[model samples]
Target: MSDGWEDSADAWVASQGEEGDFGRRWVMDAPMLERVRRRPYVRALDVGCGEGRFCRMLAGEGIAAVGIDPTVALIDHARRLDPGGDYRVEAAEAIGFDGGAFDLVISYLSLIDIPDVATAIREMTRVLAPGGTLLIANLAGYNSAADAHGLGWVTLADGRRVHAMDDYLEERTAWIEWRGIRIRNWHRPLGAYMTPLLEQGLTLTHFAEPPAHGGDPARQALYNRAPWFLLMEWQKPRAGSSSGPTGRA
Candidate 1:
């Protein structure tokens, strides 16, 4: 069977438009761009770059970016949208690039779609140059865990909305459908993401749970009840005697 993204590529692209969906536009992009702007990276790779939106944003910031996705249709749409941009049909678990090829690598809301998170993380790290940065934006573990199990918030007698979570420690795949798009996302605990990076010797440098933007007061308050997205930055250590496989980490 085809990955659901291939079937939903056009709709997905249409939904993202020039900026991105709401969570990306309001919650994620600004902080991500800010982090990237602080450094002077010449080359960047966007893993699972749906429709190349983030790649285009990177180009706008004067960084040369190459976007890769497993879905052929999404890549075609991305290429069509940016004619001159570099977009490829590739999977994150097996990135076809030389080691230490990029000064920065970004995985924006794509880790959830990948089945083999550990392998993908390793591949992403392998292509990062010494001291290069790896930035990731993902659904918060609490939100994903609750959603995967069909759990949602409940309004208490005091009018506080509370979300009760269970099965958070388990790792599994769940299907989600929105606006004629259907896709599967993997749900894993926070440690499932952090442990592998630490094991691979990448150092976590920064983390954030940026508040929701652009929504009304009530909607914004609803989103602010819990973080919808989690942003993390990890860096390969500078070249030295203690550096690991990809020169740094």
Candidate 2:
């Protein structure tokens, strides 16, 4: 499973030979980076920072950013894109940064493939500076991926076919594919997603359910009908303050 992804990461960078700026500038990375412009964070960590798109964006914004990804190819490509900030090939779960090192820690659409996601979240919390924000965007809710794939169906216990969102959530599985690489994207209720953060000594400040992009205005109009992805903002309370969770949005 991991081998295909390791190769896919390299192939992805190779395929982006040019027009890489198109994605880093206009697509996913740019939009999210723009969203955090008003944040007062000075230092940030972009975990699983594949290709360092977000890392470069942060560096451009004057934030001292460090990008870490397990794929060497991605890091190499990132270095070529922007050598200003630090870039390292590392695991999302075993980050070596000292505790309370960054004012912000972000993972853009990278949590789905992480096997021990809870452990990864804990690592992120460990590195987060006091009163820092940890932003995460990932596939959310059951049937979200099926909707993205333009499919609608459910599998009963007896292997019967049913076609409905509710039925699917109750029985079927949903997966996500990025740049032709299919991976298991575990979907959970909004509370289930927030539960781990609470356990990691973080509090959810805000949540977003954005519209999908496909070009069809009518289809896009209905995209927000069901949230396929969630942007969760969590904060770490100040050190020596209180072990209890408390933070302003």
Candidate 3:
């Protein structure tokens, strides 16, 4: 959990002011919020909640949410920005909560940052109540794979630029440097994520590669070809629950 994130905390906070970076502002915000509103949750937990942005969003709507992150500096920012909010410095892999304590658990753009995604998923699932939902926003596997080797967008002989992928089946790590921020991210194939979730007995209730909105038209068109993000709602079935699994949206 401690992979030198404290160094990048300041730059990250500055980068994600109020609206967030390009991805959150345009591609993810609307869709993620819309899906969160579909169900009511008495208690919610946001794992890997850097600066607690989404937790604050839920709080604005009168929903109480607890935000957790391992990085001390980021947690400080969260507490400083929203003094009355609940923000804890805790790792996703070792969340400090009882089993079935939260009705809603969210991992927003955090799977990539987490070094141990499997352990984190297990912990999140453990803390989730039956009939609860685990809402996630993440970098699509295709996008992650494409950037694995740092040789993105190769030019073809016919002058067409296409994203190139390598070592897709293997987990990869790379440092993302942007706007004075430098942080490490892990990339795993689509199956690497799905297999663990399925084994944990969670049902895929909804999935989608939603489109971007209110952004530059050219960038939006580019993302349409290969989505930069993905949304998934995984539900744990209640006892004797006859409700069946739902597919991709």
Candidate 4:
């Protein structure tokens, strides 16, 4: 959600009740949390922490977590739901926190929403402490259709369902509007993401286009045909390290 986020905040929050939408609840949560569990982090930050969901999750795991978002309404909701949580209204492109402040930083499904991704990524990397982890869960490039007509299964001429995609390599914005939720999300090729992080000297620790688990059969098939999300773990280089993360996978 972008400039219109205030109008759509309630619906977005409602769509993700206690768990999240299908992608977050069934697909991304387990693996994302698993990656978090792999390393011990004393302090963590959630870059686009909508409603403080992931931040609360990190707190549950005994980590001191802080959440930041550009939407004031969403931050208000987050503070209401999580009274003691640290929820701030801040943009990812320019985090107010001091550099090297967080041991673990996450940008969960918020990368596509930020209009200035390069600056946001830089800020996320800046807040990360040496040897810290930046775990990301993002929509697959194909999912953010340029036309924004929405991407899913469609019956072909032979009556076989296929996911149609026209521009996989194009960087564009998709105005996603549905069921009272309207937000602008960006679509970029893998290079649009990878190159910047690599330039920052961040090491790729783990990457996966993991499948959904223990869900409706039909839904699983749909997700398999064209993955809705992918997870990536990048580690900031320590002062003297020349290699990647200690636990590479």
Candidate 5:
């Protein structure tokens, strides 16, 4: 059980050529950059950073950023792409860094790939400096739940398209295959993602379910009916504070 990513690393990197996949280009990257640019941070870490794209983006913005991933091939590719970047072979469950080392930590679409979600979340929180932020972009619970059971949108007799969802409460691993790539992704309920941060005393600062990209109308229409991704911003409380306010977008 190698998570199926070691073999797919080349295809994955190629699929995200130059910019990124469609979702990353239209939905994830811009919003993520906007959020990170709004504040100043000395150091940033990208946990489970596939190919180190986001880390490179941060470095281009003058932020000292490092990327870590468990997959050797992907880490090697990242290092080759940005020779000066600090990319390491590390796992999300036990990041090799001191506590309070990073003012910003990002897990962009990596949580789904991590099997030990709780431990990974705790480790991410541990490395974050007090008052720091943790930004995560992941497959939404709805999409995961639906895909787990092999359910997708189906047309009704009355010309309505609806997606059927099932087993959302069950936490398990599911296989996804597409265009010469295969990977195992964990499907956990929404609470499975939020509760760990809450338990660690992190505050939910922002949440977004952005609409699909504009250029492809048909694809946009399908996504408008059901969001494919979820973005969340959680912040560690400042010294002497128990919690912070939550924001939604």
Candidate 6:
């Protein structure tokens, strides 16, 4: 795969210091991890695995996981930081895996970055085992970076800062460069994200809008300013498919 974004992603993730910090706190909660643990999936895929934080988390629990990202540096960092799990440099729209290859496929906050998100979702469904589960949690809905003034920057070619927020009009690609690294972060309404799943025959099993970490006043203010998080569980509908636990919103 031709990856032009590798080095910047590495530097950006490395800049984050640890596997559990940075902006991921909103998505990687204890309750969410527990939900993943109790699921029936044995084989899994983490799309846009970034530094492979969650992949390593899943591996630590003994579930076999393959983390895929088009950015080579991110994959390399994931390998170096989390040695036990598998990591690959591959595009979300073109994951080089066989059909029905995974019992679960997860895309954390990474979904909105891919330009052809619908195609990626379909590919995820195509490679998912019958009755497999797809878990997506991220900054979506009325809550998005757009509301956070993220729409103003331009991301450059070295993967830093080149495209502006208004550039998202293309529908297939959208990202901004921070410093010099290109970060594909697109913000869309909740329905825009969930509609594809329903069209692809995936049933919504759970939805959540957990209150932001309540301790920090600044965070609480931002949480109130925007919908900071939304978690949704989707399942490939089939007879006898287990209905998972419903979470609070």
Compared with the true structure, the alpha-carbon lDDT of candidate 4 equals: 0.86
Highest TM-score among the candidates is held by which one? 4
Candidate 1 segments exceeding 4 Å error: 148-151, 155-160, 241-249
**Residue 68 CA error for candidate 1 (Å)?**
0.5
Q: Tell me which residue pairs clash in candidate 5.
A: none
| Winner by lDDT between candidate 5 and candidate 4 | 5
* Candidate 2 C-alpha lDDT tens digits along 1-249: 453455566656655554343323223443466457758779999998877766766776888899998877778878987866699988888999999899999988777656677788889999998889998877665444355454345568999754445433342334545665554544445555566788876867767655554445654544445554567788887766654544321
Q: Is candidate 2 or 3 superior in TM-score?
A: 3
Candidate 5 lDDT score relative to the true structure: 0.88
Candidate 3 residue pairs in backbone clash: none
* Candidate 1 local lDDT, 110-160, one digit each (tens): 999998899999999999998999999999888888754333577789998
Estimate every model's Cα lDDT from 0 to 1.
0.88, 0.68, 0.85, 0.86, 0.88, 0.70
Q: Which has the better lDDT: candidate 1, or candidate 2?
A: 1
TM, every model: 0.92, 0.75, 0.91, 0.93, 0.93, 0.77
Better of 2 and 4 by TM-score: 4
**Residue-level lDDT tens digits of model 3 in 1-249:** 446689989998999997888788889988988888897777899999999898989887667899999999999999999999999999999999998999999999999988878899999989999889999999987787776444256789999988877777888888767677778888888887897787677899899998877689887877777767899999977766644344211
TM-score-based ranking, best first? Answer: 4, 5, 1, 3, 6, 2
lDDT of 6 by residue, 215-236 (tens): 4676555555544567788888
Clashes of each: 0, 0, 0, 0, 0, 17
CA RMSD of all predictions: 2.4, 5.4, 3.4, 3.2, 3.3, 7.5
